[model samples]
Target chain A: MELTIKQKKKIRRAAIFTALLLFVLVWLLPVFGALLTSFRTMDDLMNNGFWRMPEKITFKNFGTAWSEGRLNRYLLNSFIITIPSLIGTLALSSMVGFALAKYKFKGNMALYLMFVAGMLIPFQILLIPVFKLSNELGIYNSYWGLIMIHLVFQMGFCSFFLRNYMITIPDELSEAARIDGASEFRIFYQIYLPLSKPALAALGTLEFTWIFNDYIWALVLLRDDKLKPVTAGLATLKGNFITSWSVLVAGAILATLPTIFVFIFLQKYFIKGLTMGSGK
Target chain B: MKRKFVPWMFLLLPLILYTIWVIAPTIYTFYLSFTEWDGLTSPQFIGLENYKYLFDDPTFYKSLINNLKWLIIFLAFPVVVGLFLAMLLSQDIKWARGFKASIYSPMILAPVVIGLIWSWIYQPQGGLLNNTLTYIGLKSLTRGWLSNPETALYAVIGAAVWRHTGYVMLLFLAGLTSISPTVIEASKIDGASAWQRFRFIILPLLKPTTVIVIVITMIQSLRAFDFVSMMTRGGPFNSTNVLAFYMYSEAFRNYNMGYGAAIAVILFLIMFVFIALYLRQIRKGELE
Candidate 1:
């Protein structure tokens, strides 16, 4: 039987919808399992398993994790590291990016390429040297040490991002400001910096999430328990709550919340950043 | 006078921090790779002795092979799924936004969290996968996934793909959205099949994006660390060891800084070639 146009469209739409539904379910199952497991009590978890819905949904695991687990401290370290690193990176990268993007000068390509190549190296290679260097700088096991590492490493990608971003802003605005009495720094401070807010905020969100979720860096650098970021702190959770699956899952969920909020709320900016950062 | 130095002044902070923390350390790693040190005391230069040791180490071959396996699996699975999903999502559909967000949510989680979640699911006894297998009467298939050398790496790769595929889809979707609708419409009017139209018109246009997906996935696979380290720690006779983990274990755990640095330098060279090729591509594009 020859299919009518409406029928064919309907069939195709059904297929598309089914495929998308299946993909989303498959992708989200592990996430849902973790969330479901977090809500369950250990008793239920031991008896019924992680796949089943909780017999009694409870938030006590979150309470225990926050207080007894000292997740609060880890979350605090996350902010201490993420905030200054964010501000410094944004400030430094945009300044450097503005220079590279707008200026025509000698060594421009080389300088820009240096930043680009800096990003391409496997950062783990720098682990030994960076560890030793931080120790020498007398900042080992300190919050500032991790912050400095985050800032320097992120500069490459951030500069590259801001430079590319700043390029797209019509050169006219900066040129007009240059023609005026405004200094180049003033132009950047007043004009280009404000204009690049969207890129800045997006990169800031990504940078925050990244440094927050950093495992190896925190594991290597921070020796003090109080200074451990949430990611490193979560690894420690496994040792304390070896049998308490619920508490560990709850902690993981807590560790994930800020990034999740940033992701869902500032999704467009996040996607834009990801797309712009496609090749890396 | 301030204006004369303002740009350089701006360059100063980033340059100082970056050079001291990043550039110098990177270059020093090369020299350190030749010398024996425990991250302390005086260094004794041994000159390719570390690399020679790495070459003869059987575990090095195992880890290298696993990395290649990971690279191959990632290149195949995530790229294909991402492209298909990107195409699927780009089509006008109800709740596409919701579906897109749902699919991409995993990307927001820490790799450790992803690893933790999957590890539970893959548990051999009373775990999600084994339970489901028993329910479906595939009870014979159930085994300790992380402890099983043969299945361990592939199982970890599956988790990596789960996180990566969504990221890949998002990139492809961004690229797909920019294509002119007229090109698609014109092909449709010419009685071309969907596959034919995609092959002829869409694929070529997506060259830039395809380059991105290939390059990024390759780099990600090569740099695979957190998932493997968190989930398996290169266990079950080091079957799942990748260069990054092996390098990390050597440096921090064993204090074989020189050997680890050597491993890292080799990994760097492999990645640098790709980075150079990518840079060349960008320069060519600029000329166009």
Candidate 2:
């Protein structure tokens, strides 16, 4: 069958569309099912199966999860943990990054490499010791305990990212500010920080998602259930609410919403953060 | 001298925190690996006993093998899917932007959420996969996918691939975008077929991106944990257990801190190899 070139092109386009659509389905199927399960009652999900269109949908599951599943408590805890950690990481890293990127000093390169390598080490190596350390410090099972751990671990990646970003800014800007009789802190505050806003926003988005999604560290450091972030709290839900699929699914959806919203609205920054942080 | 002191002032706090929290704990773990310790008491020094036990442990071997399986599958599956999708989506097609958005939406999600979503889909009784199969008249083909030892690791890897393929696609798209359109047009004018153009030119030029993808995927698979933790907890007779999850269970669940630290050291070394390669590549570029 000698098809014309245009006909062959049409066939190729059709095949491409089919493949793309198939992958879309593959990616969305689980999420779509979770959404469906979240809306339907547990009885209906059990009897009618996930394949069936829900005969009725209710917002009651969200309410139940919020109340009974302790999602409200967990969501509140996630915010409490994520915000300060974000501020501390960004603040502390930028200072160190500024020093390393902007100065010629003893051990600057060594210090920077140490921070970078700290990020790549399998953190599981430090788990037992950090756990014991946190306990000895009397902050174990408390918010500050986890916050300190987050600060230290995240300082590595943040400093690496920010130092790389800060390096690209011209040294002339800082010099010019210095010529104006600005203090070193003034130059940083006015020149470097202002110029680095885009990178800051990008790193902020990336760091927020990371600190929000942290599970293992939170599980290891924080012992009390009330102090648990949504990640660990949702995990506890998984154990107890084994049969309560609707409420459980609702809790998962709730836990995922903040990051999902960040991704949807701040998507450009998120992508920029990812590619930039990868050292491209 | 004052100016140099100024830099140190800026560096002091970060360095202090990093040492106390990150470096000290890292050193302590290495020291603790040689000692037997529960949480309550002083660590008792026992030279290489935990490492010796890890050598004899069958579960450790199984977990290592499962991690190897993850590395192989991850390197091949997600990279191919990413390249394939990036090529298809970058073409002049309607709704390509929307298609990419839908495809990449999962990548932003937490692995726990993804695992929970897949759990519902893969649940045995009247779950999505089983029901869909039954609807299409493949009644006998459906089984407990996550419960079966042979298929359990694979089922979880399938979930991971779904979440990560978009990430691969995005990186490849960036690489593809940087490639010159003029060169492609010239190739076409020279009577090169599409396959020939892609094979000879495009793939060859994408070597750097391919290297990055390969190393990242390998490291990630070695560090795979969230799925086993969320979905199966490395169950079905420890079928889906990998090094990361096994390390967690031993340390936290069984309180075998010394043994778990040894496993962590192994995982760290494996990761270090890939990270070293990546860092060297980045550093190599820095010199130029």
Which predicted model would earn the best TM-score? Answer: 1
Candidate 2 scores a C-alpha RMSD against the true structure in Å of 1.9
- Give model 2's docking category: medium
lDDT of 2 by residue, B1-288 (tens): 588799888888888988888888888888878988776777799999999999999999999999998989998889998998898888876678889889888887788877876776777885688878987789899988898887888999988988888888888888888899999999999999889998999999888788888877887788788888988999788889999999899989898888888888888888889988777766765567
Runs of candidate 2 with Cα error greater than 4 angstroms are A1-11
Which DockQ value does candidate 2 get?
A: 0.67
Instruction: Spell out the clash pairs found in candidate 1.
Output: none
Candidate 1, DockQ to 2 decimals? 0.65
lDDT of each: 0.85, 0.85
Q: What is the interface RMSD of each candidate, in Å?
A: 1.9, 1.6
Off by over 4 Å in 1: A50-53, B1-6
Residue A280 C-alpha lDDT in model 2: 56
